[model samples]
Target: MALRVRVAPSKVVLQNLITCLILFYFVYYVSLSMCCLILQVYELDVLAPFDFKTNPSWLNTNYKVLLFSTEVTYFVCGLLFALVVEEWVWDYAISVTILHVAITSTVMLEFPLTSHWWAALGAGLISMICGGQTLAYCLFKDNFIYPDLGNF
Candidate 1:
């Protein structure tokens, strides 16, 4: 005798939800990075530790760039955790990113005013929503599901 198997629609919905979240963040990651590289300017160190350094404004720009790639990788990791390992990373990592951004803006870079604030706000909202959804899905009482991160 053969046993019959069935799949639920929730699983498909969950997969799409995860993909959308990843895509949303990925786009944000790219935009922020490009803004830094192009809109902002930086200068390499004239003569310090033979290190390339730039102005605070430039540093801000580079930071966006770094965040873009870092976010991409992190999201990818989350994706893998979902797919292969069936895991969700809803820990300090996300909070750390937010905190670091806040801290650096306050302590180091001269924050961009006007439009940038609006942009940041939007980004924050989106992140919160995505993070919240991911958390909700992870903790859902009815079911537990994790995705296999598609491709690298």
Candidate 2:
């Protein structure tokens, strides 16, 4: 026996498609960044220790340049998408910015200082809050049905 599925409304389907595309873009962006970091940057670091170096020369130069350019273009395009197309994307972008700040702070602070950790922690906290709001806007009431028992 074959199972049947109910077709969602056109608008709901469109929203789901848009959300999927946004998720796909994020995946691509992250994969590109990781490739650049691991293959192009770390592996090609001439000054790095022998164990740390991979001596990746095959397509590294061109790939790295392309990756950098594409990453920037992707970011700008995502911002434009958020600004002009979807309001929820804007919230996601803001949350992502908070995460970026946290990650940047953590990466920059090499010393074992309490203050540095606190700064990173604060950014992470803000990111979590904003991220929750973004989640609500994107998933809970927007796409799926749920209760609206007062302001969260």
Candidate 3:
């Protein structure tokens, strides 16, 4: 006897992956820009989202706000991604976060090394997954209902 494994067609998978990536970054930047505008209202650096500095004190109000706003943006992006993708929430979430980190590292000329920076990234990742799962379930709970097998 042989067991057959089924996989999605590569073209379809690739297309979906590309769509997810594009959507994730598009929503992320747009939301981040809005957050930056709010930060600017308070005279904080508008470029804080791009800063990977390890030297600044995380205790600073500016840093705290930046971190909070970033996490919120991640959550919103994840929620939107989940609503669109409607499947493979974990894979897409991790892929986008890794891509974001890689791009940020390349642009900043250094990998983020600060504990607080990493903590924020970790928190953002968690929020992304949680928000995605929560919204997806809420929107599609009926789809997940299983039929009564005992009646078979």
lDDT of each: 0.44, 0.43, 0.72
Ranked by lDDT, the better of candidates 1 and 2 is 1
| Local accuracy of candidate 1 as per-residue lDDT tens digits, 1-152 | 99998768778556545554555455544544454556553442212111112232435655345444344444443443334323233432344345434544665455434454334444544554465447556655346665578874
Please report the TM-score between candidate 1 and the true structure: 0.29
Q: Which lDDT value does model 3 have at 115?
A: 80
lDDT of the structure predicted as candidate 3:
0.72
lDDT of 2 by residue, 35-126 (tens): 65655554333211111122234465534433343344334434444333344454444444444445445655432344433443355335
Model 1: how far residue 149 lies from native, Å: 37
TM-scores, all candidates, are 0.29, 0.28, 0.71
Off by over 4 Å in 2: 1-30, 33-86, 110-152
Q: Which is better, 2 or 3, measured by TM-score?
A: 3
Query: Deviation in angstroms for 148 in model 3?
Result: 15
Q: Rank the candidates by lDDT, best first.
A: 3, 1, 2
- Predict model 1's lDDT versus the native: 0.44
